[model samples]
Target: MTTDARALVPLPRSGPATAAGTRFRLHRAGIQNVWQYDEQEFAFGDGRLLLRGKNGAGKSKALEMLLPYLLDGDSRALDATGTGRTTLAWLMLDGFEQTNRLGYLWVEFRGTTDGGDHRHLTLGAAIRASRSTQKALPTFFVTPLRVGEDLHLVEGGKPLPVDRLKEIVGSDNITDRAVMHRSRVAPELFGITDATRYRNLTQLLHRLRRPTVGDRIEHGGLASLLSETLPGLDEDVVEKVARNLHDLDAVRDELGRLERTDTALRTFLTSYRGYLSGVLRTSAQAVSRELEVLAQRRRAAGDAAQRTSELRTQEEESEARLETLREEEEAARTDLAALHDSHAYRSLHELSEHRSTVEAVHTAAGAAFTALSNAHGAEEGAAERLADGVEHLGSRLAELGTEHRELLTQAEMAGLPTGHLGEAVALPRTVRSQTVETQLTAPDGETHTVQQRSVVRVDTATVQDGLGSWQLRPGHALPDGPTLASALRPAPQPGCGVTAEQVERLLTTIALAPAAETAAHDAVYHDGSWRLGILSGRHHKADA
Candidate 1:
């Protein structure tokens, strides 16, 4: 038996109290009209009892009539010796002169019920044996009738018949059925309600009964008796086990097959995923190249448009100035016609001729000063041109290296197998990119916004000494450049269609002033640098 999954030792006082606080102590046990004696009885000491007798003195006979036979009504296990020699028929018929016999075996238990009340329960068997029939018929009973006090199994020296016992104990208290007698003893006499546990208790009691007590004390000792008495599993119970062991083996075989299938699939997918990635990466690189080419065309178109817009503005300005000069000329001609007919004009003619000569001299002096300033500016412009050329050379070197790397990458990617591109060669992925807005002053002095956009790039490289395998490599991104937007914005605008790359070439023409502290109209800043245009005092940042 177990409680909370822990095994219980069959030790005394290990369990809780029984119902009604009852304890059924064997008060007396006896038999009559069945064996050597016409009537016999024994009393127990404090519920513990022992029998003592010489060989052939009917002690074994007395035990055979009362024991498990009375408890279970089983005549086969009556001997207590594990021997089948002693039986109900032999006990009732042996040493008897009478052709027919009627007998009884009984046990009385005295105990207390709830509230300290006295109680007595009697378990008994009535036996009838006939010489003519060569058989013993038994009827069992369990009742609250106290033996020797208010109930008796015998009267007039012969055991009472079943009718006389039933009349005394009542039909409800007596049963001819062995099963009913056994069922009542556990609950009514011993206060044990659980049928299975009661059955086990009785079985253990039967197994532990000692038959060789005399021999054990004289020869074997207590240790030997206990060692020999401990029970082991029955052969029949052990045989039924392992009947389903073969079914478990079949399930294990199925699991082993599935594990092998899983391993094979994992191996194939590892190689296939690499091959697929390589093919996809090659396609992406080709698309990037095409995009770069298209971008260059767009930049060229934009530059052309800028130049055309600037030329149109210049033409319009020239026409307006020419119109103003023509209007001034017509007014001068009308004034001259008036002067020809006036005396006042004739008087100032000589004075006007002298004033014109003075103005001519002033104009010549101013022209010489202008030529001197132009020569000085030309010398400074030559030095600036040299610095500009050096910067351009450095930029060209970087661009050339980039171009070389791109060409090498293109050649390598071209070797990949992309013949089945449309047939699921590509893997779709959600691409995340960064796009920031920045201000750019175009070559024609037009200010506009452009997006500086970039995304992470994935590349596939062939593994060394491998069979059709490629490894993935991710490209690191460059850091963002310095801000060039004015205080009015302080940051780049977003969602502008113009890309930095498109106007980058024109932006490079405006030299950046490295020494300038901040942006102003005279020291303009654009595209990540400050720009003080070629020895300029003041330069227009932009108009609207």
Candidate 2:
């Protein structure tokens, strides 16, 4: 294979039957080196060529590369990652119109940055080389017309920005112009197929003839098809038919207008009667619905009244129970107070105070005994000693008597007499502190407080049957304090029978007569009078 720079024109198969007069050709086709996958290539004579391969064999890639050539390089080139990189790749067709020409178009593509990575491009260009002028020479010129600059050739040395090149080629409508011109035989050059080629031919014919009929339709147009099918029927026929219909309609309208001119009282009355009948029929239906609604309301009110009565009855019973509870609670409270003031409770307190006083007296007595013992040890001697000892003994005896009397006085002050001081006595004692720890309600719905001062007094008695009965009573007279609990019985819940949905169902079931007046009269008539009499005399009773 040799690289030749000969200019050759490759033409569509339909334009010229022979190879002469053809301006475009596909000699060697392949994806540019920038694409990192399988390098797909194609070589074709010209029309209706298919590139067939397995998946990922780059068959579509071959088509994609050649697609831009026919579209005047308006398509975006793909990156190595199969992304449309928004770069315009130009493949110029330098077709030479000559007999027996061997020509090919050269394709050159530039790579752009995709996904933040720069793509390397080693794009190869293909140009047709004749058997005569076959040499390694550049065939196609790739130019970049930059912003505020003239068009410069983009050779292998320096490549221009892909975006600037894209803007220029795209604004020129280069691809679309090529498509319109080459659409007839070459299947529009872009995504060409057999079916698409036929469709494009059909569309071209329609486009060429469209303006004539389309203009007429857009601007006060005629129905040309109807005119066409009916040869003699033109715009004049349409005007004549429309005028005839208008005249007949005018005559019929005038007759109706003339008929409405009459003011006959009897006829008016007849029409009025029919209109009033319709209005009355509608009014009656509405009233019947209203009557049905009212009846439903009455029934619902009755049901509500029954439920309210039941609630009241329950309330009355609850109130009675509450009253009983109040009385019982009041009695319990009063008894509790009396128990606090009872002799047993007060006696326990008195006994505690007396015991404390007795302890004080006992301590004083022990001190006195020690002093008496010391005084007895101090005396000694013989005859004179005997007199001294007797006098000392008498003095010590007097001191013992005085100490004894003082003890008696202290015992009396402590509320224990001298005779009772020697006896063993037990007194009531408190083991716990008093407190009102909780409040609660009784069985009958009364609230009461439980305090630490309360206690259960138990008494066991032998009955005639030889069995002992233990009775427990709550009071404040015991040695221990009261016990308390929180909370009480719950309030009674409402009945489950009555509900809003049930009431609505009942309201829906009510019925009323179609005629309101008739229904009212019948209802009143059905409710008859009732009479009652009293017998007061014996004579009237005898006659009966």
Candidate 3:
């Protein structure tokens, strides 16, 4: 680029605070008017000096101005622009525990002309809440200090115009990289390498309040990254949170197991109900057949009416016998009651409450016998239920095992992954099997195989259409397949008792297949079976 063109680029205005190629000399630097820490001054020669003070001694604020004067030749020094008071532009010309140390800057300025020599300008800035600004916001002011030809403050240079100075500093904002780096460079230049550590060391450290949930998340984001490099991070609280998450997962797993068991039970009940219905129907049929045979043979059997009459007579005699037995039982009970009411019974009761004792014994015996009988009945029911359940479970389980074995064999043949779905494949019943395999060639020309197994869960989705419907279609059946494939195969229409047009019409009626149909190839015949490869080498595209 031409010199004129280079010069045409707008040059950033320079200020004494950050003037390039300048060295500043401070004969003495200190805060003039302030507390016991203030009204202190120290004189140092040209190069550099270290200033130290105890807490509340006001050394840091002095350092802020002095460093700028030494490095860039700018100090945020208060000067008497008016009577009795100085025009203070800095928001904070004070130092404290948490104050940012890198807010001070100094710059050196050099003249391009030969024999122009160099000059130093120092710039220091601080935030001040200005009521004159909108919303009472804090406005930053850069105070530029310049030492001139007479070795005294130059005109219009002491409290330099902040607006023009900020343009050279890039920004007066404390958060800006230029300002922050300048501030940091000053402290490091003065051997304050670890400013934060220095501050902590100077004070008694105390534990802060516990972190809130949001604070913890933020801490995890930043501090967790350091954990791999740092030790002693996984403390007791961290382990406890991990343990709680683990327990929650265990409970979720238990609940899943229960749901699976419940599903299995329902499945078993469905099959059992079907089996019982079949058995009852068979038994009813057999009973009906025997009755029919007896009816046919009944005419040859003599004295049918006599047999009927005899049966009625036997029924009456049995009724009479039952009535007599009942009368005897009632009479026995009455006699026992009378015996209890008699003097002898009263005498026995007086002896040792014998009648009451015998009654208690009898009641105890009856209760024991009744309890045993109820327990036996409950046990019998439970045994029958358990037996039915086990038998059903075993048969289904065996069937599933066999099916699983078959599927595993098929999956092996297909080179599919095993153990993708556990236990179900080896369960009592398997409706269908579908698996996909992929072969990959390495850069070295070595081939590797990867298999994908899709378990066909036996339910509505698996049984919606026959698995045979999912078989690969012939190449000739598709529009583009015949032209591309080496071998051509034709597909037979499905035997659904309906023409393709009729099915198409039905699909259109239901808004499935649109009325406007295009001839698109869906398959290509390659092996003995038609290859249902939907993609073609050139023109074929996949369904979305």
What's the TM-score of every candidate structure?
0.36, 0.16, 0.17
CA lDDT of each candidate?
A: 0.59, 0.38, 0.39
lDDT tens per residue, model 2, 307-334: 9999999999999999999999999999
How far does residue 340 in candidate 2 sit from its true spot (Å)?
Answer: 99
Using lDDT, rank the candidates from best to worst: 1, 3, 2
Using lDDT, give the best candidate's number.
1
Per-residue C-alpha lDDT of model 1 across residues 1-544, encoded as one tens digit per residue: 1011111111234345445346778778876666665666677655655655446566556666777667777777777787787777887787776798888889887888678887877888888899888788888887878777788766776578789998888888777777677788777765678776666666655665656666766785756554454445678776666665657788799889999999998999899999989998998899899899989988989998999999999999989989988998998899889888789888788779978987786676466445534533553464345345434433543453354344333323333222211111111122334556667554344665644333222111111111011111233221122232122123223443333442232123212311111221111112112112422321221111
RMSD, every candidate, angstroms:
50.9, 46.1, 63.5
Better by lDDT, candidate 3 or 2: 3
Candidate 2 overall Cα lDDT vs. reference?
0.38
- Candidate 3, which ten residues in sequence have the lowest lDDT sum? 516-525
